[model samples]
Target chain A: MTREGWTRLGLVAAGIAALEALCRTKVIKPLTLVPPSRMVHDLAGLLIAGDIFDDIGQTAIEVGGAFFLAIVLGVLMGAAIQATPRLRRAVAPVLASWYAVPSFVFYPLLVALFGLSTSPLIAIGVLSATPAMVVATIGGLDRVPRVLLRAARIHRLTAAQTLWLITLPSALPSLFTGLKLSFAYAFIGVIAGEFILSGGGIGYGIAYAYESFETPKMYALMLLVLIVAVGVNGALHAWEGRLLQRRQR
Target chain B: MTRLFDSLAIVAGILLLWTGVFEYAGDSAITGPLQTFRFAANLLGRADFWQHAQATLSAFGYALAISAVAGIALGLILGLHRFSGDVAEPMLASLYTIPKVTLYPLMLLVFGLGVSAKVAFGVIHGMIPVILFTLSAVKNIPQVLLRTAKALHLTPMQTATHLLAPAVLPEIISGLRIGFALTFLGVLIGEMFASQRGLGFLIINGINSHDVKRTTAVILIVITASVAANGALLALDRRAHH
Candidate 1:
């Protein structure tokens, strides 16, 4: 990163170009190995037509909606459980078991319950991410200094003040980590659900392409999804970095 | 007694929700927990479920065999040769970060939606995680361990056997456990996309036919497998600790 970023980028670019060349050489069947150039053409076409962009927008909305739901619900639930020991003892194992259940198992159930609409996709994402958020929130809260807790009690700070001043600030970094992970869960959860339910998604487009024998378009859609994923992941990292900076100062 | 009571209460509460919904709803797919369990029992008794499971499990085995050998070998190369890490780690990470389902079409095109495609898919899913984790494990070994091996006039193979391998065995096992789950997931997705038989196929079949119970059954099987896998992994981790 420090030494000539463009050179490193060019090396990576060249490697991809070489693979593209190998694919286009026709030594292997064109259908079997889509050249990078063809893939780029497909991508450019999709971008121009704007259907792919719409799918990307819908996916982002679902992911963002579910991520928001997980943060709010998970943090509140975590705090409630943490405030009450009996609740923690009663809920932790149950939550842990549910967490271990792959969210895909519920994708069909969600579709059955809510139909093939965005609800099912978003619902699965929420369910998948909430446990991670909840678990991390509790850990984050527990890591807050015991001295601070004692001092807060002694000062008789209001619940609102304690939450904002003591708990939230102390737990900020872990909270961000939890949210980062939740975003990741949301991404996979939405994709898997949409893939199964077969409508209004890049997943649906992918299945459509496969069934319709548009392999090049299928690969292009997947590339677009990957680009979106990397972008989202990078954003999450930057967000986490900001949180870390806040902690440092 | 408290533990049992707590667990029972939780189960009862969950069952209560399912039954309440089942009773109130008009001919919905969400059956009572008891009824679902009964159906699960019936499904379990059927040979078809096991056959589908076997199809999926077999693909997992082939993939595991490929990945374990190749990944560990690659990991060793990168771990022992510092230059490999410098040049290859980012390359590997880039591939690793690529969601890999993107390559599903490529595999299908070449392997034609068969068990071979599924195996290749599984290998792609599992190998990178194993390699990266194993590399870290090897890299984190005490320099003293390697120096001791050298002082004892250990050959490279002998050093790998006694020094590097033993040091990273726990991580290697950790990687394998994750690799197993990933292989299962990959094989399932491959089967789902295009395949003849597997739990994924059954689920897909159920979806296409609008057979909710059959679809839910496949989903349940996947959940059970995941729980069993996680439990087994935890047991392995405990064993390693001991």
Candidate 2:
């Protein structure tokens, strides 16, 4: 890692530490918000005593499968529409309308269709992920220079080869962007799924903690989720950075 | 022309599937769109619909007011102060990345089941984007404009009114538009997760009671409100650009 990266991270850590100390000292009290120190240990207890790993693990499975499905479908659909000019014009407007539909409104419909379990989570994830995936894939395909497609055609590359070598490679960056966004949405979708229907996901844990008035535990669980999110976001950033570096080489 | 047909084809295909599935499931609650639209219009004719809308819009008003005032103040503060901005910007950005909908429970506890909680939740969620956008806008304010104001010996307050306000007004307006959409999303989501009465409550009650038709109606109402809000904001944004 660069010195700059380490320094920026240190600054962030310092800021969090200062906030934690303020909370501990009663400077930020009457608020009684849990400091990061208490939060970290309490969060550790939640994982140790609580079935958080199982809940989070279950959520990951549903979201993973659903998001994967969306990417596969979205890329194929996006590419198909792109290849056929008539289809592209038809699909874009419809997709845009779907995009504007407040995603939360789908929960009732999903609950009716899927009836809890992993089904609802997957349904919600697909609903949320598909639009972003489709949009990004379409945008990526559209962005690839026309000359490149023509070159592939001139080379008489097979359809599969054309896609694998020309289209997919060209669209990789946008695809990565879509994946990052879809992953986040999928997480929300899973949480929403857990909220309704039969529950027992991390979302359910959070909701249960809230209803039972386990404020500290609820606060602790939230702190963990926040950390996990930061970790996941950082992981994606690093992955993308490495890919960009490899591309540069 | 053919593309238009293709669009209709997609809609028809979806409807066909929707009808087939609903029929097999043997439920009239949500039914199909056409049936729901008729019911939706009937819903509109009722005094209850207007009352529900009034409640929702009033909550929205409070949230919007909070978001606007808070967003501008925070945005300007972050924008003008470079060192603080540097120290805090990445952290804020990271926090933004946390899927906030998941934290609805904490917000529920903090704000209670009251409308103010709903408003405050919306404001916090919506404020970040506005802050980032306006901070950039302020940073982009021309050096020449500042110099000109100083040369005129304009007081700090006068300079703010004459120079900064005029310069950043358009960007601020744009931020407000974005803020409105996000605030609506946040408020409505909060209302849905926990609330006594609102469009969200109406939908949840409708669902719990197996009132699919009513749920569908509520969904339609929510969508229409979203569309209208988006349209209004877009128009406002365009007007502000001049």
Candidate 3:
């Protein structure tokens, strides 16, 4: 690891230690925040007990469904728009400002349309996640070198061949960015939908625990979410790093 | 002229789609665009609606102000110190990608159920982008410009105003645009989960009560307001960039 990496790890360790000390000293009430160690211990016990597996599975399905759909739809739509200049011009402003409107505001409307099921949650996830992928796809396509296309034409490469061999490779970085954002947005949308309105999921579990005054349980579930989010993001970051390194070679 | 025509066409397309959905789904599930617009107009005339709007707007305003000030200051400091920026950038980026909605319970516990919790939520969602943009903007400033300022024996304040501010303004505006959206989202989510007031609460309340018209209408108003604000900011962003 670099000096910056070491320093970051040290800083995080120090922060955790400080919080642990504060909790132990009773400066921070257990009601407000349990020690980090207690949260982890509770999380392990909860996992072993396996009561929360259903909620985890539900959330995972919703997020995965949304992520898959977003990538497919976003890439197809982005390509279609890119191929048509007039369509691109018409939608550019809308796409640019899309994130400004909280799409979750439409969650209730979705529930009304689809009923109180995973469908609404997945729909909301797709609504939030798809735009990021679409935007990234457009951006990626925009950055693909014009000379590469000209060379492909000169070589008489078919459209499919050119896309597979040249366009897709060139656009991989931006598309990876899109994939990362889509996953994050889908996860956030699903979890938040559950938190706000759904009957079940890890988010609902936390909210339920909060309302029932299960403070330790709530913190444990929260710790699970934190671990999952950081772990997935770290894995993706590392994978992207490796991919880029291989590409450079 | 073409741009105006395109904008009108897009609006028409969206309305058509809305009407089509309404036709397919029936009045039980959703209202048509015209019905929603009329309902929104009526809702806007009501004083009670403004109260909810005020609650959301004020919380959002406080959050945006705090995010801008604190994020810019921190970003500037980090950017000026090369080592600190390198160490902090990845940490900040990771934080940005996390599903912060999970932390809502924690915020509610700490700040309780009020405007403060909402504002804090908004700040957390909004501030990271600003810090990132400003930090990168400062880093991207030419070394020659700093050297020239130094050669002229300019004070820190003068150097900041004359050199740094103008250079970073464009990127900062871009960041603010994103921050504006996310902050609005954060506040709404905060309201939806715990609060008794705000547009978010109204929507959830309408859903719980099965008032489809009210829910749809409130959503329309919120979307219109957000899109209008973002459009204005986007115009400002383009001007800054050019």
- Listed in order, each prediction's TM-score against the native is 0.84, 0.82, 0.96
The Cα error of candidate 1 at residue A174, in Å, is 4.1
Residue A142, candidate 2: alpha-carbon lDDT: 81
**What is the RMSD, in Å, between candidate 1 and the native fold over all Cα?**
3.7
DockQ of 3: 0.72
TM-score of chain B of each: 0.87, 0.84, 0.97
Rank by TM-score, descending?
Answer: 3, 1, 2
> What is the descending lDDT order?
3, 1, 2
Off by over 4 Å in 1: A3-11, A81-100, A145-176, A242-249, B20-28, B72-103, B139-167
Which candidate, 1 or 2, has the higher TM-score? 1
TM-score computed on alpha carbons, candidate 3:
0.96
Clashes of 2: 2
Which pairs, if any, clash in model 2? B29-B212, B29-B213
TM-score winner: 3
lDDT of 2 at A35: 83
**Residue-by-residue lDDT tens digits, candidate 2, B21-109:** 67765564356768878999999999987887777788888888888887788889978886666555655656766768667765765
In candidate 1 chain B, what residue range of length 10 has the lowest lDDT sum?
Answer: B25-34
